[model samples]
Target: MEIVVAADASEKGLGAAIMHRFPNGRDKAITHASRAHTSAEKKYSQIEKEALSLIFAVKKFHRMIHGRKFTLLTDHQPLSIFGCKKGVPVHSANRLQRWAIILFTYDLPMQYRSSTNFGCADALSRLIANRQPPTEDAVIASVDAEVRRLFIDALRSLPLTAEKI
Candidate 1:
């Protein structure tokens, strides 16, 4: 029972994707997403964002991983230090110290993986909100489910564009 986790965060939000791998190499995935607090969005340092993403992941899935020693993969190089013989970053914010303590509670071995290699988790963390135009605009999308279905059906009837083809 080996659990591999990757987490990433953006100003708009944070997300983590989890994959559980069995002895035979079979695996399954779980994804977590959440909105960022306005404060974290405006002022969280780079390191905090990285640490927080992992924290969010671990806490969100603690039930599945609490008693086990799991591998934590992250794109931020500094985070890997927490798992090394060295030491956690002491110069950064005190919040980092608190986070490190929380992480230490679990026997987590952190590894630094490039975002490319951690695609699933990386993608989970970088969600952008879909903002509709203001109400005053000419195109207020229909609230009626039937109308929306009809509109989608109409689009499906059109020929595919070159790119789509």
Candidate 2:
């Protein structure tokens, strides 16, 4: 099976995509969104968080396709950092650096995809980041459920062909 992974990072949050090739050879995209550090001074933290989120998405994909060949694509520049020995600029915390090191164990190939090609994941990350917080548990649960449903529905409709990068 062939899979394509995409990720996008903003000051406020991060988003990732796992595009899987089905038995019928059709691509299906699954996505996840998470909040992250937003301050300009702490921009490195934001990038680290985005990288971890991308790693999380890869783990999710691995669960679905164990031992399968896959490619990971990200809009972030300096994709070489994924294979670098020295610390990367965006990795502030040792934990984040360790996470990057651990992800390499999967031996998945990393590809540098342009930002224009990752619009869907970028949009989803923004949408999640913009969500209003509710004071009540019930409201939070409702909102979370709705967001998950919407994400799944959007993934189902994503185009198989790679967007022009």
Candidate 3:
């Protein structure tokens, strides 16, 4: 399997996308958006939130693929270091180290992309970041439900053989 992943981050929050190629030539996609980091904006500390968010997105992809080879794309360049030995520079808090460890468990190829080109992932991230719990609850709920339905459909459609049983 070949996969393309993308992530976007801003003052509001983080968003990620994963596109995969199956044996049948069809593609699979997964996206996630979550709250931004609100902690102090110290030198390296600012990346802590982004790193954690990236880890979350990667893990979500792993759950979907079950150890398939995948490529990761991100608007945040720091994440491209997962393939590096020394690892990327991060805060003294060791956030990068923690993220790198988790990343090693998967077969990931990293790449960088501009936010403008990230499309769906960028939109989802911004939507989640700007969401207002009171007014946007219904809209968010609808989108989440739709995504879940799509995921289930995709899983059910996966090629599985009963003869192996």
- Candidate with more favorable, higher lDDT: 1 or 2: 1
TM match of model 2 to true structure: 0.58
- Candidate 2 per-residue lDDT over residues 1-165, each given as its tens digit: 577666666665666677776889565876554554345423466556567656656665567545666666677765557744554556356766677776666656777767776676677566664544555898889999999999989976877535632
How far does residue 11 in candidate 2 sit from its true spot (Å)? Answer: 2.1
Candidate 2 residues lying further than 4 Å off, grouped into runs, are 21-46, 83-93, 129-165
The lDDT per prediction is 0.74, 0.64, 0.65
Q: How does each model score on TM-score? A: 0.68, 0.58, 0.60
Model 1, CA-based lDDT: 0.74
Over the stretch 3-105, how does candidate 3's per-residue lDDT look in tens digits?
7665655556666777776889654674554554444522334456556656767766667645776666666675667755566566545667877888777
* Candidate 2 accuracy as lDDT: 0.64
lDDT, residue 145, candidate 2: 100
Q: Mind giving the per-residue lDDT tens digits that candidate 1 earns over 63-136?
A: 87898888888888978766664566667678888888788888878878787776666676666465533464
Clashing pairs in 2: none
Q: What is the lDDT of residue 29 in candidate 2?
A: 77
Worst 10 residues of 2 by lDDT: 33-42
